[model samples]
Target: LPPTGPVRPDSYDFSFDSYFSGIGGSGFFLGDPKLLAPASTAPTGAPFGARIASAVENAREGIADHIRSSIGGSEGEIAAALIVGVRAGIPEAINESMRRTGIYHIISISGLHMALVAGTIMFLLRGAFALFPDFSSRRPVKKYAAAIALASIAAYLVISGIVVAAERSFIMLAVMLVAVLFDRAALTMRNLAISAIAVILVSPHEVVGPSFQMSFAATAALVGAYAGFADYRAGKTTAPPVKRSFLKFLSRKLAVGVGGAAVTSLIAGSATLLFAIWHFQRVSPLSLLANLAVMPIVSLIVMPFAVLSALAMPFGFDGPFLYVMGKGLTAMIAISAWISDRSPVDAVGLISIQSVLLATIALVIA
Candidate 1:
């Protein structure tokens, strides 16, 4: 271990007990650093997981190089971050700007990314099956497609370095897949509850982490909102037969897109606001604005292009897709930066311990 360097009031005192308890670390070492000779060999044998990780890392590096060559600057870094969850190339200024604007989650490996990948796969597979009468009519192509989507999500989670939030999302996706296999509703409060329970059982410590808390909070809020308005949705579906022209249809779709974006941002932002203030002590006043501007581009263009590029790389046809992906990422970065620049500075401060406790209780109850 590196030197502790003048222990302060909050300095972590290392010990064997702490290590065993998972408090500090496993051990400490003190030695003069020396460089190894070029001819010296180290461990190179990789297990299945190691091999998978190596492949993922190599692909990320290759894609990063391609992105850099196509579109330099923070855009390449943003593309790599969005595609593979590799943010090492991202500049500190961009990171700071994202955090300030509350749009950093876009680049993080979370439910958004998982949902995009799964939804895309399921849609494409179902569409292909629809085109083939034999599969759609005689076989259970939807369930099989969902299973394949689950597998793809698993691969993505692992390659992106599975963390607590990703694990929860995967569990939810898995539960949904199982539901589809059994011909049950996929999106329900029960699925979210099961996923939360599983995540807590696997890593109870994650309950206190922002990723776990914010994710469940957002999902729960959405679930409750949908449940609350189920009757309205059911009623509306029975009387929605107003035929329109192509131009009118296009206008309606654009309106729905804007409205849906606003509502989603509102729900998610409201759910995570207190948690953000409690954990990071900062609230991005422009979070909804930033998300509204960036999410459409990310989901519709950046992520799809990146995923296609990734799939095409093995066939040496990824350059065009990556170039388009970089363009989308560039626009996204500019939007986020602009929003961040206009947002106010200074972190939101909790008034007292009582307020914090109250907020925590409210979140838990919700």
Candidate 2:
């Protein structure tokens, strides 16, 4: 999709979740989590209405478990993002940036994060298992690796709670893990396609939502593109150049943070902007720079700590880590709030959900 390229053009993943606050009328949009429970506080929990919350939580746990167990890799970074946890305030330049951006928050836990995580964990775990003799054992290390990932994924589901994009990613990854266990060949495109089918069958109404359609559309595009690119690159001439040292590579990672933040904003914010374009009433240009400026710190330092601390808490030895994570998260909140207060954030609605879906279909067809 011409409109969806900034985040990871080839993949159906772009979730710039600017906020996770229950405010901004989120319940009105997130559709259904396929589970339900009554609304009681604390230990009382949900009452007779088990149809809403309980089912959703159970579904999330099951999906998370399956996914983590399927990974022969490290998707920790992506898994950390499943919650759509962070919520930054709007920049001050355009005062209405708040209401619009808030109103525009889409499902953040989408397929791209899952793909990145699965691929990352797979590559890392495989490499680690390769180098370390301890892990290269007669035992079912691959299976265990997948299991651990699944456990982590389940924790992720409970911690993050909000389900949309992440759920789809979780489901697909789980299926692939099953395939791995069955000794079947697994390809990304095929896996993604199958996942799409499964998601639709289970939740027919998902077809009517922007999160479901957009998430898959973006992911499919990326998978197809990357596969084609990989083949193309393999056949290209002029292979080698002056090799850079580790420091150079590290620099790229750091730089990638800025680029990634901007890209996230572009992918998410731009789509929303399209709807407001006709009236010249919506625009989110500042979101990119604003996100770029802080997201690196969030991704590299803050998010990791927050995720780690949260994970550690269940073990009853998390205070220290929790403190660290809390501080980092706090810093992010403060920074985002300050920036929004200072900047001239402007935005315009660009397209309707219908148009977005049509464009996504056009993208799929192309």
Candidate 3:
């Protein structure tokens, strides 16, 4: 083993004896290692890319610090995870609870978070432009909003550390925003395929990782299901109702919202089930119920306030917004805890690689 010493910028050379381990084990073990090194000084200046990365990292830390100062405790940790993909401070128990409840993705900073951020920004921008009808009508306000939203997504990608899931989401979203700019269909299998190809091209190794596989699997399933539903709706020949009561309309909207959330949870959970089990060795039986209960809080309360808080931060008015976000996060954590406590025991035994491959093929055909 190398001797313990002060941290240094010097390169090192190691010499060691290697031996093979017992059956069923892989890789050689090193024995009687010796280290040799030449001292070197640290670089005086970073490359441009490194400088930009350092700035984004500092900004991410600042945002996390602000969240902790304002919210504190587990809620602050969760807020940091949700907004900046910083999960380092989340307690192991809380993390386990979320995983058991099948809502761990809530903290993972993936498509849902990115979509909400971009959508909120676009909505606000378009609304602001609509206040001046003459300008809004004269200009392509939607495209302009898309352009800004795209820029926001890019900034968010950097700030969130550009993990596999975030990278995939960014690519997909960028394609959609570019589609909008070109007056083309945004959400389609073709666009998704493009995004997938782009991701694979950039990070081929990630294709084998759970983050890439499960993220794409869930997205593909959702897109296919929604596209099929769209086709089914298009085929419907029934005439629209000429009149409806306001109460009935409100109830219908509520029903659709609840049903959509439930369906989304089911589809995504089902799609990612194999990968989740293969990677983590757990099955979340109550995931649908947990998602149904908590997703609305996340979507309607947590994320909206998250965006507001971020926008309000520069003005020092983020406290109220962060507090509201913390309230929603508190509720979400409670719900995860409750559901996780009652979740069934995980499935035992290993699944074969062939089985996973077959499932993937079936998913594609579907």
Who wins the TM-score comparison? 3
- Residue-level lDDT for 27 in candidate 2: 25
Residues 107-192 of candidate 1 have per-residue lDDT tens digits of 78788888888888888889889999976899999898989999989988876766556777888778888888899888798888
* Candidate 3 residue-wise lDDT, 1-366, digit = tens: 433322322211111111111123235467884658522322348687877777777788888988998999999999998888888999999989988888888999888899999998998899999899999989999999999999998988888898768888899889989999999988888888898899889877667667788888888899899999999999989797868899989999999999999999999999999888766556888889999999999988999899898888999999999999999999999999988899988554557778889988998898
Ranking by lDDT: 3, 1, 2
Query: Superposing all C-alpha atoms, what RMSD in Å does each candidate have to the true structure?
Result: 4.6, 11.1, 8.4
- Model 2, which residues run further than 4 Å from truth? 1-143, 158-166, 176-187, 241-249, 252-283, 338-358
Instruction: Give candidate 1's whole-model lDDT.
Output: 0.78
Which consecutive 10 residues in model 2 have the weakest lDDT in total? 71-80
TM-score of each: 0.85, 0.58, 0.86
Give RMSD (Å) of candidate 3 vs. truth. 8.4
lDDT of each: 0.78, 0.51, 0.84
TM-score of 1: 0.85
* 1 against 2, candidate with superior lDDT: 1
Rank list by TM-score: 3, 1, 2
